[model samples]
Target: MAQLTSIHRFPVKSCRGESVGSAVVEPWGLAGDRRWMVVDDAGAGITAREVNRLVLVHPEITDGGLRITAPDLPALEVPTPDPARQVPVAIWSSTLTAAAAGAEADAWISKALGVAARLVHLDDPTRRPTSPAFSEPGDLVSFADGYPVLLTTEESLAALNDVVLASADTGRDPLPMTRFRPNVVVSGVEPWAEDDWRRIRIGDAVFRAVKGCARCVLTTIDPDSAVREKEPIRSLAKIRRWDGATWFGINLVPDTYDVTIRVGDEFEVLEAVAPGSGPLRPAP
Candidate 1:
């Protein structure tokens, strides 16, 4: 059995996350995770994929609302928009309405990203259903990439780093799991063992593995320095590459609500596919 070693919560999308001891799992995701996001002047989503410096934006969930701080900027406290003034926002291919964070947050985030941007919150997360291909009818997600949560194991990271360190041209020392930005980090598993997991339980909540998370160049960016490198992505291509993309963590959708998943919780596989060939499978 694997153990849940860490639980990370990203209050605002594309920003630095906070490691928590425990959190309530809502149907869409962890209660304060990805509920807010930065958008362009046109209401399209903006992420660190384009502006690596966005990772330097640190957002923390406070009892009343959100407090955001950046490298040289003073901390700003933002209250949840009262009465939820709705505005149209586009995330990926999905179009939805969210609460606008007003001109204050917009101006602050705009300066942080060095672009014209606005901040918005998913006051009603139920408005966005997850992808039809990988999710059930009622499966919902926040401003996350797709699924409700992303799961990764330490064993897999260690194995991937081993191969990364062995590469002659690899410039990185070793990649940390933070680069993957997983919501739950599990320990005590063989490398790539999660490839066969179809369903899993972490404490009181059950989750169905929607799909293996296809990593992109965004993973190559350092969260601290915002520097972009090619080794992790380049090395990931060598071993985890298949299906025309490099694979990393597993995206999961929770089957239970109101369950608080804590650090050091028991993680068990409830179902699995037959061990076989796939992009997420272990290299032979």
Candidate 2:
């Protein structure tokens, strides 16, 4: 039986995430996950992809809002922005009105990143919908790249690491699961078994495997050191490359909003599409 072994939530996009024993599955994703984000002067979403140091920023969800802390900077507690303070923000291709966290929060983030940046909050995740190509109608997501939940398997990580060690010597260390930043990690599954899963049930919640999470330069950024290196991305390209992208974990969209998932919860595959089918495609 496959059991969920880890639960993680990034209260702020591209920032360090928190591990929890349990998480509430809302319509968009885990509660408080990616509810806030760092944006450039133009109000476009920023991530570790460009500024690796962003991963060093840690956000703790507080009573009213968030308390963000980073090296060489004092912790800053920010209250939820008033809805009337909404600003137009763009995350990828989706543009939506997000509540601005105000100048105090923006200044703190700007100093921490050593770049002009602003902090914005997603007052309602439902304002942005998932790509219709991979999702059902009316499917919504938080400030995530696309899907709601990302799931990875321990066996797959081990297999990828073995490949990395066997491949060209880059002097890079074996990668940790954190490199993938998954919302849920499943143990006791065959390596890459999730590639074939179309529908799965965890506890009382059901989810549709929407798409394969394509690898990117962000995967090369070390979470702790804020340093970039040729890595898992290099190795993944050798084996998992398809359709011009390297694939790793799978993206999931839940069937409903009101489910609570725990680390020890058992998961069952209710349906599976054919192998070699695009990991993100709906089962025919």
For residues 1-284, what per-residue lDDT tens digits would candidate 2 score against the true structure? 78899999999999999999999898888898999999998999999998899999999998999999999999999999998899999999899989999999999999999999999999988899998899989899999999999999999999999999888565656899999999989898889889999898887788999888998999888899899988889899988998899999999999957889998999899999777776757777
TM agreement with the true structure for every prediction = 0.96, 0.97
Instruction: Superpose all Cα atoms of candidate 2 onto the true structure and report the RMSD in Å to 1 decimal.
Output: 1.2
Put down candidate 1 lDDT per residue, 10-114, tens digits, no spaces: 999999999999999999999899999899978899999998888999999988789999988999999998645988999998899999889998899989889
Q: Stretches of candidate 1 above 4 Å error? A: 168-172, 277-284
Give RMSD to native, each candidate.
Answer: 2.6, 1.2
Clash numbers, per candidate:
0, 1
| Overall lDDT per candidate, in order of appearance | 0.89, 0.91
lDDT of 2: 0.91
